[model samples]
Target chain A: GAGVSQTPSNKVTEKGKYVELRCDPISGHTALYWYRQSLGQGPEFLIYFQGTGAADDSGLPNDRFFAVRPEGSVSTLKIQRTERGDSAVYLCASSLGGGRRPYEQYFGPGTRLTVT
Target chain B: GQQVMQIPQYQHVQEGEDFTTYCNSSTTLSNIQWYKQRPGGHPVFLIQLVKSGEVKKQKRLTFQFGEAKKNSSLHITATQTTDVGTYFCAGEGGGTSYGKLTFGQGTILTVHP
Candidate 1:
């Protein structure tokens, strides 16, 4: 089975420009999550989706960061007015269940976003 | 807000030596998961622990969840070059917050032959 995957392995954009990153979760996975990883740091949670609705989004840094999982299988993280601080590896993951406790998550290769 | 902290941000060991990383949470966690990420790669799930004072092993790797549910540890016996990577511990807060995971800083392990 194909694992989770993201598009645009690398993206370089000018600061203040808008950008969108896509994620394709594994088949039959109902729980999808987005995280950001900075250099020399662990992944920071960004948002989570259960089905077509966002189950948790407290991790989103600000209103400039938004994500949507319209079909419950694929998701997109959108950034408005990107900043240099937003430059990092954007990771996407999915689990078999709807984020039940102790469920293992499969991760995607990630999209490295560089705001120049 | 919950925070997960990991100690010994980096570890260097020779082959056949042992390596360990510790994770602590300010709040009690409903479950904890461990992940490994090789350089220039995405994170891969290794294991998850939900029970208090639980211990699980995968060949040379050992994982332990504290009785308090606020701490965890990963220990590797007889380290191999293949084990060189970053180990991260992520915890899910108790209650209805099932999808959000608070990740620790992570520990980078380097094994020399």
Candidate 2:
């Protein structure tokens, strides 16, 4: 079975530019989540999706951060007008069933986005 | 607004020494999960504890959930250099706040052989 996978393991872009990070969840996983991890800190929740709709997006820092899971299997995190503070590793995770329980989440290698 | 605080932000131990990290949450958690992330790697799930006052063990690692369900601890006995990494405890949101996990600040463990 394939674990979660993310594209563009490393991305460096100018501040104010737009960047999109993609994630491919594990097969049969219905719960998907995106998180951001800054250096020397823990992961911060960004958004969550169950099926094709986002169930919890309160973790998103601002309006510039948006995510979508169109088909329920893949997700994309879009950052508009990226700021230098947006530099961090973007992590995507997925679990079986909806996110009602604390099921073990499978994490991807992550896309390190650096806003220069 | 839930927060999970982890302590001993950083630790260094001998190859055969023991190590422990504690996680405390501001709110009562429905369940807690532990993850290990190696340097330059992503987090890997280790275990999950759902019952109050429950303890689970995996090899040399022991995980305990507090009776109040607001805290948890992970202890590794006789750790090896391979154990060098960061350990994080994530608390699952209860009530209508499902689908999101509040992760601790994480404890970085360094082991010398």
Interface RMSD of each: 1.3, 1.1
Clashing pairs in 2: none
Model 2 stretches astray by more than 4 angstroms: none
User: What C-alpha lDDT do the candidate models reach, one value each?
Assistant: 0.94, 0.93
Q: TM-score of every model?
A: 0.98, 0.98
Per DockQ, the best of the predicted structures is 2
Mark the 10 consecutive residues where model 2 chain B has the least summed lDDT: B93-102
Worst 10 residues of 1 chain B by lDDT: B93-102
